[model samples]
Target: MVDVEIIEMYIPNSPSTLIYIPGITSSLTQPELYSTLHQTFSKFGLLYQVSVKNVDSEYYTYIRYYSARAASRARAAALRGEIAIKDSGPVRVTGLSRSGFPNVPLSRYKCEELANFYLGFSGWRSKVLYHRKEESDPLMVKYVSVVSLEFPRDSVSCEGAGLCEQPLASAEEEGDSYIDIITKTAKRSLGEAFLAAWGKVLLIVVEGSKVQVQINTTKEDQFLYNPVWDEPVVSVSEVEYTQDAENEDEV
Candidate 1:
């Protein structure tokens, strides 16, 4: 029996990698401010994203780095009057409190977005080991999917499974609806299964100019996979692994 698991991806909840810069009144445009902020903060580490926002009549910028260590260094530099976003004056940097850190849910689409940006097109790959429909009671239909993900460059791989079930049509339903029902159910099941496989907390590490995704499994609460003991009902023939640059769900 294959050890099927679920990769429950989540953003870091503590040791925040995000910093805030308030009272950033700049003569430069928003884009210029963004660029300046990127250039200024990126010197500490590779940045995940940067944004400038206006609260009331004042402007502030948020800088997010891939590494918490980098954020700490940047924060310390600002505190010591060594770093300034603009020549207007030396600015203060503030780190988000542990409870205030954002922990966004790792949806399938977001996972791919981050992966492609950080890991590049050829850095990782995924293959569907099997996607098979299960024979259950007449009132319900179920599908099971097993997939494998590999980061060839990093030499890391893991297997995950997804299971979805839908209600079967009643005998009174039109016959034509049977095909539609099956198709819709199968697509949902496959999408969910793929999400389970793609969803894992990816800790982005940056060392100067190099960046890599490190699978974060230190938090025991994030491992959310439980497998059923049933035998396989159907299996697909050799499915070749493919690299997808475009945003396409493997359904």
Candidate 2:
């Protein structure tokens, strides 16, 4: 692996209710994550800070490696998001398998109270990983839904979505690197876990999106917009879509 390091930052928006988590095989820097967050949660803010760490080639090793950083980032994200959002109503956390654990204290924005959406696998199992706390607050978690993204029960759809691209094995064999299982899971699971824990889910999948379809579209566009996954994620000027493919002679 050639110096695979991940950078963590918040999406910074408000009136925020929904949160989408990415999957384990990749990082949240993927365009799919940006698009979903940009479109579905438009106007909302992201308050979490991700910790970049070293991962072994065994992506699943994250369960052990990144746990500490995940905890800190979860707490930080929670604090930042909580303060930024005006909605005192329930917050949502949505994601795939590892991301199902977003409820665990991996970022500032993590907590049972903030859980609103959960799209994941082994949800109950993931939630089982959190520490118990006494409830001083009177609110019951407003859980959205738990959609399993595994083999058999493989899909769903909603007004919003969380998309992720997996690490290509060919890239793995060569020097191309990828995020570890811990970061991937931490990024992926929390929101879906929230749903499984809470229950009123509004799940949607991109069964079919037009090439021109738009989602995760953001406001003001002040973002760290880098599409590359193996290095630190950054934001730059948006790229021109090239509008039309090559005309007959232009090809």
Candidate 3:
């Protein structure tokens, strides 16, 4: 194996998150790139989440690991510039500290109207609450449903207009809660509609009566007209690295 020099671009204070900037070569969509990175990085350690974003037609992958050590090791390996995808050149990896990656205010609203407005959807009557914290971060909020809904066959009506209704007791007899049944039905009926409205969605997960919608807000800053994660992780510049090198020589 060829040994490439490891350049510590930015050492984050916490070192739990690492950003990967891939060379321009692949034509995969943001969601597809996210899936590929998640699967590849999952081998290193337990992952909290993986996000992909496009800036100026280039792709960047932000990976957060549960173990800081795992992130550090990944960063070292990535810095060597050895990791690469088929048809893509080596990627640049930079470690991010907690202070480096600032968390934006996340707000959860109970009103469907507000949710619809933020989600950019119209004629949506489901009681799906919206939770948003970052306007530009690639990883958005995840909605998990605990109980499902029951809708009439012909009219497709839910129990409440803006609230998730409790599952019926009879639903337990069939080994599946009413919430689970309704959640699946809703995904089948309204999943496409939601995807069309919210282009940032990464994946949709349904467990029992609950449905989890994972949002990917990559490049949202451009569309939302706001900048959140666009700021540099650290205030310092590359000069810090040169100063450290000179200090080591003096020692």
Query: Which of the numbered candidates is closest to the native, going by highest lDDT?
Result: 1
Off by over 4 Å in 1: 1-9, 27-51, 76-90, 101-105, 113-120, 132-141, 166-188, 198-251
True-structure lDDT of candidate 1: 0.65
* Order of the predicted models by TM-score, top scorer first: 1, 3, 2
All models: lDDT? Answer: 0.65, 0.28, 0.43
- Report the Cα lDDT for residue 77, model 1: 86
Clashes of each: 0, 54, 6
> Which portions of model 2 show Cα errors greater than 4 Å?
1-111, 114-126, 129-165, 169-176, 201-251
lDDT of 2 by residue, 1-251 (tens): 23222211122122122233322243433344334333323222222432222244111111111222233343345445541222222223332223322323233234221222122233212222321122322222111212222212323211211222333454456654444422443344444343333232212223111111112223122112222422447776786544446664452
Superior by lDDT: candidate 1 or candidate 3: 1
Q: Per-residue lDDT for 20-63 in model 3, tens only?
A: 45444577777777787777776665455577778888786777
- TM-score of the candidate numbered 3? 0.34
Model 1 TM-score relative to the real fold:
0.57
lDDT per residue as tens, model 1, 1-251: 43222222555345467888888776777788788888888788656678899766557887876556677778888888887655456777776666455656566665666566567888888887667788987877777766667888878766666667777665226553656666766777667665665654454444433554555544332234434433556677888777666856652
Ranking by lDDT: 1, 3, 2
Please give the TM-score that candidate 2 achieves against the real structure: 0.16
What would you estimate as the lDDT of candidate 3?
A: 0.43
